[model samples]
Target: MMKAGPSQEEIRRHNLGALLRFVHVRGPASRAILAENLGLNRSTIMALTSDLTAAGLVREELPRTPGRRAGRPSLVVRPESTRVYVLAFDVGVDRLTVARVGLGGVILDRREAARGRVAASGGASGAADPNEMVNALAAAARSLVRKAGDEATCVGAALAFPGIVRRSDDQVMFGPNLDVGGMAIGEVLSRRLGLGVPVAVCNDANLGAIAEHERGAGVGVNDLIYLHGDVGVGGGIITGGRLLGGEDGYGGEIGHMVVNPGGRRCACGSRGCLEAEVGERTLLDLAGRQESPDVPGREAVRAVVDAAARGDVVARDALHRVGTWLGRGVADLVNIFNPGMVIFGGTLRDVYLGAAAQIRSEVATGALAASRERVKLRTAALGDDTTLVGAAEFAFADVLADPVQVLARLRGAPASAPVP
Candidate 1:
């Protein structure tokens, strides 16, 4: 038997989601702009906007611009930023960040702390103690939620994890730096936070690409690569305006891409991986700081770059070598993907800033002319918050997709969910 088409109610829900997503990403937009962009008639747009407005997801207002045009002004539809929010968690190698991100892509509050590397007992270095980690994250998230107070609604929570996450279930497949692999961190954190929302977990690099594409330097550029550096390197690739998540959601493991045969051993036990060559340890080792305890956070990477800027030969040379390797790896990706932009983020942002010349030179020599011609290399515009913002976007996905129903579900949540 043939499947039936979508009912009118389903279509309305879709349109509602589309309209909300547009306004959420593009900020306040006029009804006419919404109608034009959504390919909906003016009356339909008005109806949709009215529904969202009544649902407290959006509100219509006069245009902020002064002076009238030839026709009646299209009222602007604005997301209810203050009233709606999500908890965005960024689990980096050096630190953990939790944020209260409002509906209109605004981060209203956040808590960040230096988080030392974790090592699960009786397991390979990457296996995690889920309970301990969740307790820590919950402690910070508690303060954030408390600050949000009673007026706001937290619709969901999302985490940007550094390692490979099994997309189907948000399972951490490998993250040696945090020892979080093979743990149900999402479910654990949800239980700890007791927020009554499923905590969504995804690869950090993928989220970084999403944030940059939507709100950072990659804006307006569809095909782009975002390379993030933490304890190790990670990547998020976007192509034709969509994330290139291969089957099983493990496609963009660019860090493990073998860049140098028989070179340094990677954390994944692979030899000569891009991450092994250009990651934090390699940079510090090249700069002669390998003997020291792994300095917490990006401080170690930033210190090297700072020294390089101060004319320290060792530091400068370290940056140049790492940047070259980074460039070579980038060139290979560029050749394969032919992206319009390549964004350097996390510790890579500092590395890119210090050795931009060397990185550019390597890219020039290694990449095909046609492919390299228009590719823009730049640091993440969101600075330290790229992945954090992306986490918020992920958390907000359900609400943006089906505003009315999502709100209904959230509203239906038991009021006895316990007080903060």
Candidate 2:
């Protein structure tokens, strides 16, 4: 709501905030375009841009991409190079991946560590100790922060887990693979790492969906579903351009959605869950006569996918079977939401190279005519980097909201008098 009479100072600050947000989300913009986009007068744009420049949050540069030559091509304004970078941690069962990201979705560096965890009860289903993994992850994050150098103004981290996440607060409500039912990831990591940055934790699949929607295949669409096909089948739903965290932040657990009345037992203690049916382990089993002694489940599936792409009929058939299951699961989403697109991401998409065509074919055949027309199926364009990038985006948003306060916290400064 617009205030009846906003003071000139307030209006200027509001306009500057809006302009910064636009640049942060959409990258660089020329003064003419920004003025037109914000519907602000040229003088206002000039003033706001100058203030941002003084804050070291915005800068001007010649256009990076080619453009029309109309009177010297005015410089474009963008977030400054010294703006803080977001740390993204994409946690998986067998690997812990990290990326240092800046505004505009640029990844400065990325690395991965082994997922050797101290499991519970000596069962394969149980992953490494949650506390142990968190410690290691925090250390890695600290090292990365140092590596990012002093220019990293603030940090925003999102940990992608295979579990139910609480929406109102970023907590791992439950994660089967981690062998922990409820975990407060945000609180623990913040204390241990002391990076002085806000942390946002969420399900890996949901982040995958976010990454897809923001920069990958689902871009320009308002409503979509992104499915992660890897060690397990997971899903994230976006409706009206927002990630629907649901009542429990577990709304997109489509992998656990029953595809068959009676099927394989899922690790989550359910029978016939989609994850049980067509997860990476299941796909690997169907791909080869027997599991290779030396290869892990994910690698085995990748091998088969490589074989399939090289013209192996049996491997192709296996991939098609997984694709068929994918389509079956997507059909349910279409029936309910009628999203504009369904993006398939993660290891499954990599394994099933032609899987999108198969899912599309089945959806066209099985889904309602209107829903089918509304949805277009495709694989993720960002590949496995989707979750990491999405987490980075989440972090950037968090930092930009209250940069001064966050920076104070990061630098161990006491807050001044509260706003009355």
Q: Which candidate leads the pack in TM-score?
A: 1
Model 1 misplaced stretches (Cα beyond 4 Å) = 1-3, 63-74, 118-129, 290-294, 415-420
Clashes of 2: 2
What is residue 297's positional error in candidate 2, in angstroms? 4.5
Q: Worst 10-residue stretch by lDDT in candidate 1?
A: 119-128
Model 1 Cα lDDT, one tens digit per residue, 7-103: 9999999999999999889999988788889999999998998999888899888777854568777678999998899999998866778899999
Root-mean-square deviation of every model: 2.9, 4.4
lDDT of each: 0.87, 0.75
